[model samples]
Target chain A: MSKLDQFESVFKAASKERFHYSPQELHSILVVTDLPEHEAKLYTDRIRDYLPLDGENITWATLTGEEFDDIGGLFEGIEKYRPDLICTYRNLKSQGWQWPYSLGEYLDVLTQATTTPVLVYPHPEKKEALEKLGQLKNVMAVTDHLAGDDRLVNFAISVTPKDGTLYLSHIEDKRTFDRYIEVIGKIPALDTDVAKTTITQQLLKEPRDYIQSCRDVLAQHESSPKIEEVVQMGTHLDEYKRLIEEHQINLLVLNTKDADQLAMHGLAYPLAVELKDIPMLML
Target chain B: MSWFTWFASSPTSVPASLAASQPHAHHAVSLGVTLFFLVLLILMILSLALEEKLHAKKSVIVGVFAVVSLLLADIFGLLPLSQAGRFFVENPLHEKIEMPVYIPAIDWGVVAIILGSSVFVDVTSRSGLFSWIAIKLTKASNGDPKKLLTYYGVMTVLFSAVLNNVTAMIIVGSLTVVSLEKLERREKLLGFLLIEGLLTNIGGLLTLISSVPNIIVGNAAKISFAKFFIVACPYVAVATALTIWMGAKLFKIEGLTNEKEMAAANEKVQSFDENDGIESNGFFWFATTMTGLFVGTLATASFLPYIKDLGMGYVALGFALIMLIRYKSEADKFYQAVDWDLLAFFAGLFVVIHVMEHAQVLALIGKGLSVIVKLGPTLGSGLVLISASAFSSVTDNIPLAAMLAKILGNMNTPSSSGLWWSVIFGANLGGNLTPIGSASTLVAVTIIHKHGLKLSFGEFVVKALPFALLQIALATVYVLLFLR
Candidate 1:
C-alpha cells in the first residue's frame, strides 16, 4: 500500500476548516515525496502510524540526487505523480527556494494537466523547542546554515530594549517506544503548548540523562543545524501563527514525506502552506 | 379727633398711615434680583473676553468681584431681607416687548464668509486692468454706450454675488466709465451696474456661507454642510431667476444704438485683453479648504463642544497662524483686505446688545411680540421678517441680523423651518433697500461717487428702490410658501 493510503483524513480535516485552503475536489489524490534520500530509510510505515484510514487517494515517491540532474525530467515526474501535494527535503547547498521561482517549473508542469497543492512538513523539532521555551524552560536557537558552533553570535539578542544575556540549555527529550504510546493518549487532549511541555517535562524527569543527550548532540555538531525532536498535535496552523509571532521565528525546517500522503493527512504536510511567508527548509 | 381716629380707624377715608407703613417687599426683591442679574451679566462678559485665553484670570476676577459685591450688599441689607424680598418673589411683575426672533450664530458664519469672499473678489477684480481692457474693447466700436453698459451690468451682477454687491458695483462702475470714455456715455453704464447690485444677491443666496444670515440659520439649526447646500441651492436659484426677471423689466432701456457702434466697442474690448493685475486666483485651494473646514466645524459643533469645533472664531486663529507661516510676505497685504473695522463694529455691537440684554429691554420687547403671535412661530416669523427688514434699512445688516438671531434662538416648532428661512431672507434681502442697508450698498455708492456719477439717496430710491423691494418681497414669499 502507498504511504498516501495511510493518512487521508488529516488533509480532509484541514480542507473542512477552509474550502479555499482545500484541494479543489474532495476526492483529489495527494502525491507525496521524500527527497535527498538518506542511507537509512525513514520508516515508511510512520505514514500509516497516525491519521484516519478512509476517503482518500494518495501515492508516495522517494527521490535522490542524480534524479534531479535533469530539471525537465524532474518537473515531468512531478506532474506524472498527479499529486495534490509534493513534499520533499531541501538541498543543503542553497537557501530555501522562493515561490514561483522555487516551485514554478513543477507548478508549470502541473498546470499543463494537473495543478496540485504541494505541502511539506519539516521535522517539528524547532517548533517543539520554541514551544518548550515559551512554557518557561531552557531556550534554544536554530543555528544558520552557515553559522558554525561559535555560539556568541545570538548572545546579544534581547526581547526588551535593554540588552540581556541569552543562554542555551541544550535540553533534549528522548522518548522510548513504550512512552510514545502512552504519549498518544495525552496528545488527544493537549494543545501544541501542552503537548510540547509534557514531552519536555517527561525527558527532564531525569534531568541528568536529558542534558547528557544534549551534550552529545552539541559535541557532534556539524555546520548544519541538528534536527530537534518533532511533536505532533491536532492543529498545526494556529500553533504555527502563535509561535512565529511570539518567538519572532523566521524559518521552518522540514523532512521529506510523501506529498500524496500529506495532502491527504497531518499538519506535517500543511506546514509549507502555513509558513509560506517565512523560509521553510527540509532536512 | 385723634382719640376718635384711634378707635374708628380714621373713618376709613383711607387706611391709616401706620397701616400703609407696613412695607411692601417687591422693591427689595426687585432690587436684589436686578443686582444679582447684573453680576452674572458682568461675569459672562468677562468670561467671553478671556475665552481666547480662558483660564483662572477670568475665574479669579469674577470670583473675587462676586464674593466681595455680595458681601458688601449683604452688609448694607440692600440685598432684600425678610418680607420685602418675599413680596416680589410671591408676585412677580412681567414686562414684555416685541422683538424679532431668529436662529443664532449662523449670521457670523455668513459675515465671515462674505467678508472672506469679498476680500478674495476685491483682490481679483482689477479696477485699472478691467478699465484698460474695457476701453480697448470698446474703441473699435467707436465706444458705443449701450454695449459698454451691457458689459458693466453683466460684470456687476457677477461680482455682486461674489463680493459685497456695492464693492462689485464700484469696481465694475469704475471700469464701465473707463470703457465708455470714448463713447462719452459712462454715466449710463455706471447707473446700470449700480442698479444691478441693488437686485442680485445671487452669490449671497448660493450657499449658507455666502450670506450673513443664512450662516446664522445654518449654525443655529445645526444643519450639516452637505444638507445646507442641498436645501439652499434651489431657493438661491429661484431668487436669482426672479431678481433677473424683475431687473430686466426695471432696467429696460429704450432706443438701442446701431450695430456699427456695438461693433466698434466689441473691437475695443478685444484690444485691451492684457493680463496685468489679473492673477490666477492663486489662493483658490487655500480658500476652498478653509471654506470646507469652516463648514465642517460648524456642522459638527453640536456633536463636539470643545472650543476647536465651535465655529470659525476659534478655528480661524489656527488658519491665520498657518497663513502667517506660509505666506509671511503677503500677510500685511491680506490683513489690509480683512476689514477689521467691520469686525470691530460687530464686536462693539455685540457689547451694546449684551448691555440691552442685561437690561431685559430686548426680553421685554420679545414678550410683547409674543403676545400678538401668542408666541406661535409662524406669525412670529412674519413679524420678525417685517421688523428685520425695517431695521436693516436703518442700520447695517450685521448688528440687526445678529440681534434678531439671538432673539429667535433655536425655537422648536413645525413652522420653525419657515422662521429660519425667513431670518436669512429678511436679513440678506433687507440689506438691499438703502445705502445704509448693507456694507455692499455703501461700497457701491462710494465707488459711484468716485466715478463722477452722482446717485443721491432720493435718486437711488426712485430708480433702484422698487426693484430692491420686489427682491425682498420675493424672498419673503419664498420663505412663507416653500420653507414652511
Candidate 2:
C-alpha cells in the first residue's frame, strides 16, 4: 500500500476502536494529552472493528497520565461519570514521572483515587483481536503471484483449512479455478475440491463445504485453522447490509487494499450498515 | 517490578498454547527481530576492525557469541518455554507460515558488564570528579612532580568507591597536570598524563555499576541500588588504588620549576557572577539533595512493586526541575554542558531493548547463563559483564546499562546483592575494555584534541592494558574479601 494508504488504514482502524462509546463521554469526559481529539476518535473507530460496542458504560481516556496532579482533574471527572473502565494510551510520556510525585505518590493517585478500573494501553496493545479471522488460521498472502490456472490451488490454501475442502470467491470474477501456478512452486496436493464464487452467491457457499475444505488442508499439517466462508452481497455499503442479512457471516474481514471509498465513506458506511453486534476483526 | 513480572509470566511456562484454546499466543518474533540481530553483529565487527586498541580477537569471539544467540530464539524453538504468542508471515507455501516466537527470557545484563568500565571513563571525566582532584594536588605540589603523584593509586581506589575509575582518573589526573604546569614553563608530558588518567579510570571500577556488565548483572538479578553501592564500595576503592600505583610506575613525571613563568600562568581571573561561584553555595547542599533523591527512589523501589505508580520519575524530576528553575540561568550553562545526546542515545537504547524483549531472543541467552551459574551471584555477574563489555564496544553504554537494568529485573539473581551493583559493575568495568568504553576517555581525548594532540589505538591499549587488568584483579580481590 502507498504511505498515505497505510496512514489511512491506521486512522481507519484507530477510529473503529472508539466508535462504540458515547460521543459525549469521548469528547467531554476524557481529555487525551498527546493523542489529540482526532487520534482518539480514530483509535475508538479501530477498536469498533473487533469489539462491537453493546453500548455499555465504557470510558476511554486518551491521555498519558505521567504525574499525580495530571490525573486530579480527570479523577474528579471520572468520579462524576463513574465509568466502568478508564484506559489511557500509555507511552513514555504518560507515566507522569515528574519529580515531587515520587513513585509512591503516583501509585497512590492511580490506585487510591477511584474504584473504577485503570487500564494502560500501550501502542498496538490489541495485537490478537483478529488473529483468527481467516478460517485456514494461517494468514495467507493476497499476492496474485502465480501464472495461469494454478491460482485455484492458491485460493484453496488461502480459503480452505490445510486439511479441508477449498471454497474460493472473488468480488468481480467467477471462474471454476484461478489461472496461474508456476510462480507459486508446486501445488500442495490436488485432492480437495476447489470452486469459485463471490459474496453475491450466499446460498451456494455452505458452511459445511468450508469446513471440509479446511479439513483437507489440515491433513498435511495438524495445526491448520477450521475454515468457513460466507458471501457478502457487495463491496459497497448497501450490499453489505443485504449480505449480512442473507449470509449471516460470523465475522467480516476487510483489507484496505481494494476499496476505493475515500475517507470514511468506504468504511463507516459499511460499518454502520452491517450488523453492528457481530464481531468484525479489521486489520 | 512485581507488576511487570506478573505481566511477563513465568519463563518456564510458555505463553503459547494449542491454537484452539488460547487466543493470546500470537506474540512472537517478526521481521524486526532478524533485523536488529543483524545490525548488532555488523556493528560489533565494524567497531573492532576500526579501532586497534580494543581486543580484536575478542571482537571476533563476540561476533561468534552473538550468532549463537539465534539458536536460543523463537524460530529455532530450542528452549521449551512458550509464553510467547504465535507469529504469522507469508512464505512460499500457499498457506501462510506460522512461526513466530521470541527467545525465552532474554537478559541484557550480560551486555551491561561488557561496556561498563569504558563508559565510566567518560562519565567520571565529564562530571568534574577527576578535575577537582587534579587541581587540589596541583596546588599542593607547587609543581613538584614527585609529591604530585605520590598517592595517585590510593586516590583512585577511594574515588572508585563513589564514582567509577574513569572519573576518578580524570579528576585526579587533570589537577595533577594543572599543578605540574604551575611549576614549569614548557609543558611536555600533557599527553602522557592524560593517557595515564584514562588508564586509571578503567582500572578503578571494582564495583558492579562502576563497570558495564556488573550493572547488567545486578539489575537482572533485581538487587537494590543502595545495597549494591555499599557492598561494592570497598572493591572499587582497592581497584582504584591499584590503578594509581600502576599508573605512576608507567608514566613518571620529573621537572624543575620556572619561577618567573609559573607566577605569570598562576594569575587568577576575577569572576563576574559571584552567586554562580562554587563558594557562593556549598557543594555539600547540592550533593546532599542529589544523594537524598537518589537514596529515596532506591529505597522506595526496593519496597514497592508498584513504584511507577508513585510518581518516582516525577518526584526526582520535580526536584531536578525545581533546582533548574530556581537556578535557571546558572543551571542552564551546566544543562548546555550536560551530555544530552547521550541521553537521546539512552532513549533509543530503551526502544531497541524493548524490541528485543518483545522478541524474546535475548532471554534464551539468559537461560543458558542461568544454568552455568546455578543461581550464584558470581557467574551471573560474570555473564552480565562479559556480554555487556563485548556488546558495548559498539553501542552506547547508557542504553546498554538501561537494557541490562530492565532484563536483570526478570532474571534469577540474588536479592541480597541488590540489582544496582550488577548494573554498576557491568556498565563501568565493561566500558573500560574499549577506548569508547567510558566518558573520561572521550573527555581526555577531546581535551587533547582541543590542544592538538592524539593517541593511536595501539598507544591507548599499551598504556591501558596492564592497568585495566590490574584494576579488575584488585576488584576481584575486594569482592572476594568483603562483598561475598
Candidate 3:
C-alpha cells in the first residue's frame, strides 16, 4: 500500500476502537525557525495552508532565531498568546548567527522548556513528506517514563486522523537500567540487587497504568483513532526501529525531560537522523 | 529630646572661659584608653575596607568596635556622662532663650530616618510601584538603550533625591536587569548599573535628607530643606546629564541603529505584563499615596517650622508606622524587609565617630581644617571638597560625614554655605570613586553580581573614577561660582 493509503486505512480501523477524548481544538500556532525573517513568515504561512486551519480562528506567528534566543522574552510571548502548538524545523543551521546550541539541541531545549507540543520537521527539505501526504495515519508516541507521557499521548491522538492507528510504545533498555541501578548501588550500603529489583518492578509496572490512563483520555472523543500499546525490553535504538517498521509509524512523539541534558545527549538527534523520514512532535 | 538639633545648635564660637577651662587629655582621660580606642577604630575601618575578603558582616565588626570603644571611654572617665548641649534658640515668636538638652553621640534622628526610609521603600517596591514605572518607561523608550538610560537616569535621580540612595539603587538596578533581559542586552547592563549607581549619589546631593552626609552636614549647618533644594538642584541637574552622556561613551552603549534589533526588543517589551509584579491594586494605590505624601512633607519641611523642627526622621518613621498599621497582618514582613544590618552598621559607625570627638581626635582634624578655613569660603570650600572626596573614597562616607561635620562645626568660620555644600558634593560624589565608598555603590555592585556580572574593586574604581572627577569638577564650579 502507498504510505498515504496505509495511513488512511490504519486511521479508519483505529476509529472503531473503544476510546474517548474531548480533545481541545487548537486556536493558535507559533512557528519558531532559524530561517531569515521573511522566509520564516512565508514558511509558517505555508504550514498554515497545509494545516488548512481557518486564518481568523487559528492565528499563526513566526519567530525567527534571534527572538528564540531570548528565552525570557519568548516565555512572555508564550504567556501572552497561549499558543496551542509550536512548530519548527530540526537540524537548522545559519551563518552570521551564534546559536546558543546546535539546531537539534535548541529544538530539544525549546520542547523541554515549554508545555506546548512542538511539531518539528526533520528538515525544510522534507516539508513535502510531512505536509503533503497530509493524512496522519500510523502515529507512535514513545516514552521511557510511564506517567508523564499523558501529554504526549493526548497530543498524538489530537493530531491523528480518524482513520489512523495511534501506537503507545515504551522501551526498557536493560543495559541503561542496570547502569542506573549500579550508580544507585554506589551510594554506600545500598543493596544493589534488591534496589534494582524494586526499581525494575516499579519501572515495569508504570507503562501498563500509563497506557490505561491514555486509553481513558482517548475514550472521551467519539471518533478518535485506534489506540494500541507496545512494550519491549532491549536496547532502545533497535527496539524503536523494530516498532516503527512493524507498525509503519509515519509520525513519532516523545517527551523531553531536561533541555540541558537533552542538548548534550538527546535521543531525538540520533533518532531523527536514523529515522530521517519520520516527523516528530516533541513535548 | 532632639539629639540632632541639640548637637546642631552647639555654639559656633566658644566663649573664652569655656576654651580656657577645657581639661587636658591626661587629666580627662589616660593614654591607654585613647590608644585602645584608636587601635580598635583602625581595625574596624580595616575590616570594613576588606569586607569582601574577610567575608564578615561589617555591622558586626563595627558594632563590636563601638561597644568596646564606649566601654573604654566609660572606664577612662572620657565619657561625657553629664554633658548637656547648651544653645540659644532664636524663637521668631518669642525672645531668644538658652536651652539645654541631652545629646547622644549616635543621633537617633539619623537612625530613625535610615530605618524608616528603608521600610517605606521596601513596601513601595513590594507593591510593584517601581516595577510599574519601569515597565512604563521601557514601553515608552521602546527598548532603545539611549532612551531607556535617560528615562531610567532621571527616575533614579528623582527617587534618590527623595528616598535613600541605597533604596533608589535597588529599584533602578532591578528594573535595569529586567528591561535588559527582555532586550537581550544583558552584556550591556553592568555599565548601565554602574552609571545608575553614580547617578543615585548625584540625586542624593539634591536634598539635605537625600544622603547620610547631607543629613549630617545639613543639620550641623542648619541648612533648611528648601534651601538645600534651591542650592543643589541645578548642580544635580547638570551632573546627572553629564554622567549619563559620559556613561553612554564609557560603556559604548550600542545605539539603536538596527531597526530589526529594535523591533525585536520592542516586541519582547510588549509581552511584559505591567501588572505582573503588582501585588494588589489597593496596596499599590495606598503605597503610591503614602509615598507622595511622604515626599510632599519633605519638600515643605523648610516652610513648616513645626515639621522642620519635628525632623526628617520623625516624618519618615510616622509614614512607615502608618503603612505598617494599615497592613497590620503583613507588618512582620515589612519589618523583615528592613535592612537591620545597615542600621546596625551606621549605629556602630556613629559611636566610633563619637569616640573620636570625645578623645579630641576630632579637634586635631578641626585644627588641620582651620588652616583651609583661613583661605576664605571659595578656596576653603574648594579645599574641603577635594579633601572630603579623597577621604570618603577610601572610607565609609557615613563616618567621614560625621567626622567632617564635627570638624567644620568647630572651625572659626560661621555659616559657610560654600563649605557645607563642598562637604555635600565631596561625600556624595566621592562614593562613586570606590565600590566600598558608599552603601549605594555596594548595592549596585551586589545586584550586578547577582546577575552574573562580577566587578572587582579595582574595576569598579576604574569605571567610577572618571565620573567622580567630573562631578567633583562641576561641584567646584558651582561652589566657587554661586556658593562662595
Candidate 4:
C-alpha cells in the first residue's frame, strides 16, 4: 500500500479504538497551585463556583507547588486520583519576587510535565476574571494543526458550560504549511499544484478531524454544547486573539508546547497579560 | 543406557566415512570450529530471546553475527566454495547429475518474501481495510460478545493466513478491545483477546506464508503452497473450533444474558463509522483488489510451474514493486515499513543453521532424534510435535524450525509429511504458550497492557495454557490420522 493508504488505514484503526471512559459520577479535576494553602482553597473554591463544579458532574482536589518539586512528581502525586483535568495556578511574579524560572520557562516545565491538559489560572484575578470565571459561556480551543490537538479540544468540549458555544479553531501557520508543500512538490511524481493542494489538505486533515472528534464528544454528552469549527490562515497569536475577541471566548485552551512557539513570536507572555482574566488550558 | 550416551557412540561425522582417516590435527581443528560456532550460535539465540531485556535490536545483533559467522565459516573451509565457471563448463560426459551445492548462508528467497510481504501488508494495513473488515464483522455479530469473539477468531485465522500473525493479532485484538468496550464487557476482552492471540498462531498454520516458521519449513521441505494449505486447512478448522470453545469456557463469556444489555452494546458498536478510516474510496477498492490478487497468487502459485520457479519471494517482491509504483510519491514510506530487523533475524538464523550443517551437528541431532522411529512413525511424529512445541514455547521458533528441518530432512524418516506438519504445528502453537514465543503474542500482550489491562506472564500462561494444549493435542491426532 502507498503512504496515503497507510495513513488512512491507521486513521481508521485509531478511530475504531475505544475511548476509555472512567466509571465515576464526577469527573475528577486536579488543581495545582503555587499559592499558600488558604489562597489555594479560595482559588479552588472560586473555580468550583465559576464552572459547573459539583459533587455530581465534576469534583476537584488541590495540590500546592511545594508539595512536589517537578511536574513529573506532581503528576505522580495525583496518579491515584486519576484526575481528568489538571488545573494549575500560575501566580505571575511580583516586581520584587525572586523566581528560578521565567513565566515562559515555568509554563514550559509544567506543560511538558504531563500529557494531561493543564487549566492555567493566572493568579491575582482581574475584575473581569470573577465574572468570566463563574461560567465558561464561550470557549475556544486553539490548535497549531499539529497532531494530538484532539485531546486539547476534547477537554474543551467536555468542560464547556451547559448550552455554551465551544469554538475549535486552528491558526494555519502558513510558513510551516508552505515548507511542507515545497518539500512535497520536489517529488518528481507530483505536479506542483497537486503537491501544494495535497500538502495543504494533509495539514488541515488532523485539525479538522480533531474538531470533528471534539464535536462527536460534545454530541454524546447529555448537555451538548454548540460547536463552531474554524480554520484561519495567518499567524497564530494575531488570529487567535481576534477569534477570542470576536467569539467572546472566555476560556482558551492550547498545547503547552506552543508556550515556546508563542513566546518566539512575542505573543505568549503578552497574550497572558492581555487576556489576564481568561483561563488558558495548556494541554 | 541413557539415550544421550548411546547416541554419542554413533559416528557423529557426516557420511560416517569422514571418521575413518582423519589425522589428529585435522580432527582437533574440526572440533574447534564446531565448538566455536556452537557457542556463537547459542549466544545469538540468548540475545534474541532476551531482546527486550538486552535493550538491543535483534536485527542488528543477528545481522552482524550472521555476516561474521559466514565469513569465518568460509575462511575455515567449513563452508566449501566452488568456482562459478564449474556450472557453465558443463560436463561433456553423458548425463551429468546435478547435486546440491553450498552457495550462501542467507536465503535471498526467504528475505525477499518476508520483506516484500511485510511491505505489502503494511500498505494494506494503512488503508484500514482490515480494521474496516473487523468493524463489519463486529456489526454483523449484532452486539453479541460471544459471536463477536467467534468472528474475531475466524478473522484472526484469515488475516494470519494472508498477513503476518503479529499484524493479524493487532487488528483483531484492537477490534476486540473496541467491541468489548462498547459492549461494556471490557474485562472479558482480555481473555477473549488472549484466545484470539492463540488463534493468530493457529491461523498462521493454515497457509505456507502465514508465519515465518511456516515459510522456513515450507521452503526447507519444498512443500508447495497448495500442498501446505490442503494439509493444514482442515486441521486449522478443527483447532480453531477447539480454541473458541476452550476460550468461551475459560473466559466464561456466555452470550449476552440480558436482551436490553445486548441492545445497548449493539447500539454503541453500530455507532462506529468504518468509513472514517478510508481516505479514498477508489484507493480502498484498488487496495482490496490487489490484496485478493496476492492471496490468489499465493494459493495458485504452486500449480503454475512458471510462477513456482519464479519463487514465492520474487512474487512478493513483484507485488511490493507494484505498490511502490502505484504509490510512487510515498515510495519511501512503504520502503521504511519493511522490518529490516526481522530480515536480519532470518539472515542470522540461516547463517547459524548453515554453521550447524557444516559442523555435522545437524546429522548428530538427526541420529539422536531418529531413535524415536523405533517406537513407530506415529509415535515418532507425535514426539516431534510435543517436543518441538515444548521447545518452541520457550525460544524463538524461527531458528528451532530451521534446526528441526535440517535434522528431520537428513533423517529421511517414514511419514515425512507427518514430521514436517508436527514441526509446523508445534512451532506455531508453542508461540502461544508465552509472550516471547511469537511476535504475535508479544504484540497482543503489549496492546492489552497499553489498554490498562495488565496481564502478567503467569496470568497469560493461565489463559493461554489450556487452548495451547488443546490445539497441540488436536494437531497430534490430526497428524496421526491424516498425515501418517
Model 1 lDDT, residue A100, Cα: 17
Tens-digit lDDT track of model 1 for A1-283? 1111111111111111100111122233332332344521342233222212223454445444445545565666655655444443222123334331233234323323333433333332234432332211112222211112221112211111111112222223233333664676577665655555755543433323322334354445343223232222323456556655665554343332334652312323354434544433332
lDDT of 3 by residue, B1-484 (tens): 2322222223444332332234232335445555666677678777777777878787988888888877766666565333343444333342334543222556787788878877777667667787677667767888889988888899999889877787778777777776787577888899889999999999999887789898888877878777889999999999999999999988988568888988876766654546655658999999899998988887787667788777888888888888777678878978876777777887778778777667666766677788897898778889989988987877777777777787777663456567877888888888889988887888888878877888998999888989999999999989999988
lDDT of 3 by residue, A1-283 (tens): 1212322222222111112244647788888777778877777766665443455777777777566555566666567767898877666544312332345555645676777777776455566555653445788887665454446666777777677888887778788887888798898878888888866765664576557656776576577788888875677778888887788887788765554663523555567556655667776
Error of 1 at A267 (Å): 99
Off by over 4 Å in 4: A1-283, B1-40, B64-68, B71-76, B82-103, B182-184, B412-416
Q: What docking class should model 2 receive? A: incorrect
lDDT of 2 by residue, A52-139 (tens): 2224554444443332235566565556655544433323234332222222232234433454333222233334423422232222
TM-scores, each model vs. reference: 0.43, 0.42, 0.62, 0.64
Residue range B1-484, candidate 4, lDDT tens digits? 0001100111222222232122111322465676677787788778778888888887777777777776776677554323331211112232222222222446777788899899888777656687778778878888887888788889999999998887788777766776676677888968887888889998999889999888887877878888899999999998898888888887887788788887877766776667767778877887899999998898888676788767888789888777666678878977776777788778777776776677665655666787875568699889988998988887789888988876776655433467888889889989988888888888788778877988998988887887888888888999899886
Best of the two (2, 3) by TM-score: 3
Chain B TM-score of candidate 1 stands at: 0.63
Better of 1 and 4 by TM-score: 4
Q: What ordering of candidates by lDDT runs from best to worst?
A: 3, 4, 1, 2
By DockQ thresholds, what CAPRI class is model 4? incorrect
Query: If both were scored by DockQ, which would come out higher, candidate 3 or candidate 4?
Result: 4
